[model samples]
Target: MTTDPPPEPTGAPAPTSTARGARLAFRRWRRTRPFWAALWTGTGGFVIFFLPMAPLGQILQVGVGGIAGMSGGVVLMAMALLILLLPGQRHTAGVIAVIAGVASFPLSNLGGLFVGMALSVLGGSMAFAWLPEKPARRRGGRGLLRRTRSAAETPVPPVSVGSGSP
Candidate 1:
């Protein structure tokens, strides 16, 4: 019998090799750990760290407050890295990240104008709540109903009907 090629998907154009590779690579990386949590946490940390030091068209001077804010941001970013690298320590990292985010408010320009604080808190929450998915169980056949042995192969004995008193 002559073999036929499988039909291509409709509506969407085929992805280029580089695009496909990148997508697959990202998917693989994301599946292995809490990628979003790490990214958000790092972003929040960056904002918290840099906002205080940034000069608003004037002589820039980072004082003790800036230092504190920078420290908090660094802690948050470290926590994010911890979560990404050591997923087992996610809970600890998450808690620390949240605390750092909250602490950054007074220290880092109102927690990077609240944006950084929000991102840090959100990222920490996600890390804390993240859970591994269970693998699906597979059977060797299709359809919902399972195959069973024939009734004749496992016959049931007949029961006689008797009408008298017990």
Candidate 2:
């Protein structure tokens, strides 16, 4: 007698709405965070340098602007680098950085421009050093490793028996 055929399996379950929402959130974060951060950092750096320089004639101390400006510069640069590194938002960052730098000039009597520029460089450099680079990953070497290990662990197939050999 002949046997009956097996039944077909049904399709996979659809992804839940929560998963969909999470995915959407992730996309937005990836797309928007970088630009916003870059802008914020640059603007903050500008303010750090510009705001303190008002009242155009007072004896502006070296320590006053230097420390703050330098620090601000580092922050701004980091933000810029982050925008680039983050892979989503440099356009916003670039625009904000330049605009803020320009704005700082008038706001802080041209001192902010210098300070912001300095900070941007310093921060960007530091971020560059910290960010991971290419040329550090494995390509197809896993296949070789797997073959060697399998040979060691598994036994060779048995030889034919009809020849009467031991």
Candidate 3:
């Protein structure tokens, strides 16, 4: 005996919210090398600019003013923005960020200098190391949907009546 197929679902699938979609997209983007580099470089630069550090005179025994100690951080932040905005130019931006980070050593006090330099260098390296991933090619000629056999193409076995004789 044949049985009927299960009934189809009564309602439509749940709709995804725009906010959730946006969040998912953002999460995916954050996983990329460029995003991490931009984040680290930007955060490092901001820290250097905001955090208090030893006075220039105390660190280098020079008469330079406090503003001079924050210039490297500013450069780092600018380069990070460039990398984020124009990923195609990441190599150039990364190189500039590295140079600016190194230069920050002499310009800034010890506190911001080491941390800022380390973060900026790491970010720059990440940017430089980024390589575009290639898309995978689909295999086989089959479409996404599965093909079902037509009723005519399916063969049915012979159904016999109760016959006791061999």
Candidate 4:
């Protein structure tokens, strides 16, 4: 008598390549918390520094303050961009940003003082909180999930010799 081969099993649908890539990208981005914080703060700094100009002109009747205000806002914006560019040096950059934000207040840009200080301080705090993650090692070498042994490594049960049978 001949036996047919076992039927193939089918169940879950496979994920598409695009879905897999997106998942990987998301994971990579999620791991870099400090980088995201820096980026957001930098963007907010730029917007806040420039957004007040029109309002200031309408309210205070100053198209633009003297060089001190302009330079301070420019410097704060520059520091924010610098932080975004150098995530590895986030702590140092963040501290500098916070200091610059404070200085911007006394320099005549109150808008920069509030928005820049709040965002930069938060970003700096995040940078301080971030910890470097270790690289994942291959399985079977003191890893969390060890690989199962191949068929070659499987032990064979010994057969009894010369057993009496009908």
For model 2, give the 10-residue run with minimal summed lDDT. 124-133
> What is the alpha-carbon lDDT for the whole of candidate 3?
0.73
**Which runs of model 1 end up more than 4 angstroms from their true locations?**
1-15, 55-62, 140-166
lDDT of 2 by residue, 56-96 (tens): 45525544544454444455555566675664345545555
| Model 3 lDDT per residue over 39-91, tens place | 77887777666554565566465445346657767878998998887888899
Say which candidate scores most in lDDT. Answer: 1
Per-residue alpha-carbon lDDT of candidate 1 for residues 1-166, written as tens digits (9 for 90 to 100): 9989989888676668679989999898777788799889999999998887657433236567877888898998899999999988989999999999998888888999999999999999989988866677776655334356556666679977795649
Candidate 4 residues 89-120, lDDT tens each? 76776676666556556554664647755665
Per-candidate TM equals 0.68, 0.31, 0.62, 0.53
Candidate 3 regions off by >4 Å?
1-16, 31-33, 52-65, 111-113, 140-166
**RMSDs, each prediction?**
11.5, 17.7, 19.5, 18.4
Report, for every candidate in turn, its global Cα lDDT versus the true structure: 0.86, 0.53, 0.73, 0.61
